[model samples]
Target: MTMKKKKTIFTAVVLAVLLAACVAVDLTLPSYHIAVTVIKKATVYALVAVSMNLLNGFTGLFSLGQAGFMLLGAYAYGVLTIPVAKRASVYQYFDGGAIQFSLPEIFAGFLGDTVGSTVGMLLALLVGGLLAALMAYLIGLPVLRLKSDYLAIATLGFAEILRAFFQWNALGPITNGSNLLKSYPTFAHATPYVILAGLMIAVILLLITSTYGRAFRAIRDDEVAAEAMGINLARHKRMAFIISSFFAGIGGGMMAMYMGTIAAAPFKSTLTYEILLIVVIGGIGSITGSVLASFLYIFSSEWLLRGLDSGKFLGINSPIFKNGFRMVVLSVIIMCIVLFFRKGIMGDKELPDLLDRRSRKRKKEAAGK
Candidate 1:
């Protein structure tokens, strides 16, 4: 077989094995297991970070509105998917709530509980994405015209404005008005999250390899030159913005499912900053890097450096190793990376490209020998 075919087969086998392992672990292990939660959170963030990368890394759009789009998705999914029977309890604060119905429950009535509910959840996720995309399209029209820091500030302001709007009491009927939206459907295992995130990333990879993706890259490199080359900057930029927001919305839906509760407070500028930082550290334009960095960030923050918060690490009792110290260490590490390795781990290169380079190198060395 050709080396290309061998690589394809190898990649497929690896992915299959990984998926099976995730399923086994999710089924066999306890729900509260650290590995399970970390993986789930990482998976969600990976999707969001990739979406951010699509805008900032590939399209040269300095958007900081991911948190806003995510909030919209979380609220949309949570509001639509809450069990009908439980709505009264969940919305007790807002005059017994505004929305009295549930989409998934309706689906269950017609399609049977098992299949219908799953399908309904998927549809709700799609609705959430569409809502986010719609918002992006509307917002992009005006905001996409801005350049660099101006665009970033505009998007950041929009996110804050969105957060405030969600918290407004007048909109309480739809958003629960700063109150927690709970009792929504949740994923029982990491398997579903893994599958969904992988699918989304695969779709993004396909988009990045398309003609439009090349246009986006050209814009990122030189907007003036790309325009001279007959590329429509406004159209492509808006397309990337809408597409990124769509995935961000889906990621937010997955996050809501993972958390089993939703609140507007968590989806803030800070969340956007975190995801953007992940993209920067992951090699801004590389999907594989974003994913790998997501796992690493989660593991380091949630697992490895957890002991630092409690002042116990390698049995060393240092006074400085108290609460918030973990973040300090993490921040320093990120700073070091930014200063020394600005291009990040993958440096805008995909994993397949790196593998191909290595294979070529090996062949040359073998021939020389």
Candidate 2:
């Protein structure tokens, strides 16, 4: 068969498979809601993982500011979309509260009045992305110049500083310092997590397939080599870092909105480490690995570890283990994955390459026969 015909057939087959999978996934099961919630949580970690992969996996950068970006995005979206009256209720010190967008303020047409909450949520997500992107651009400037461990420390410190800044009395008008915020909007249906998961998956696919993504990989493989070949290292590195931060921020924003409260303490070093563990366990540079790892980590924490320690069986109740048990098991799992599989599950390989190799091998065997 001609190459064009073969290509067309392959494209059709893939499209059919994807459509079938979507349909299958859409059909509800007994744990439909639970699965959706898990998927959403997985998506947040996956987005941050992909962003980190673009830097550390593909670009050879080792930064750890995902938590910071997430916080920034979360707060930005939280503050922006809030209704002015509700702001004071949600965060007491503000007094001024939040500004509400009129139908015309949010939309452009006659149907704006009837645009619905879904449309408004989408807009809020977009705003989150933009704000995160802007924050990333600003942060990327000074930090991107550093290399390796220094960069990682710098980024980690940046996150902590941001957390501290939020807690400062000067910023109390918005964040309300140590006080908890309430009465904010929530993504009640499938959970903010489901929306976040879907978005991160779409974004990971977009970045890895795009020309910009290729550039990111090239820079990761060898910065000097990439620069010598006219790759514009600084510009591309900055771009990749900013994009990662932007999505991370969006994830954070979604998390904040869903939780209906934001506190500086919970989002500090511990949050950063948990996400880092998710990324490392998932494989540093592999989007698929990150995604799989997130699910594994979250689910295992919720179910497997609990089962193991609690000794819960077919009909017997066992004493539950302390909360720290899950973290200990998770850490061991991460270490094992790192030690046994250094390159991660996907490593530097794209899924398509494996398929291509399989097809070529089959073709060769057939020709010999």
* Per-prediction TM-score to the true structure, in the order listed: 0.96, 0.81
Model 2: worst 10 consecutive residues (lDDT sum): 102-111
TM-score, predicted candidate 2 vs. hidden true structure:
0.81
- Pairs clashing within candidate 1: none
Per-residue error (Å), model 1, residue 97: 1.6
lDDT of 1 by residue, 1-369 (tens): 886787777678777998898888898899889989988999999999999999999998999999999998899999999988888888887775888888889899999998888988998898999999999999999999999999999999988998999999999888888899999887778888999999999999899999999999999999999999999999999999999999999999998998888999899899999898888899989998899899899889999998899989988988889999998999898888888999998988776566687888999999999
Task: Name the weakest run of 10 consecutive residues (lDDT summed) in model 1.
Answer: 348-357
**Candidate 2 local lDDT, 64-146, one digit each (tens):** 88778787777766666665556656666756543444222255344454354445555666677777678778888898899
User: Any idea how many clashes model 2 has?
Assistant: 7
> Candidate 1: TM-score?
0.96
**Model 1 segments more than 4 A misplaced:** none
What residue runs in model 2 are displaced by over 4 Å at the alpha carbon? 1-33, 96-116, 191-200, 308-320, 353-369
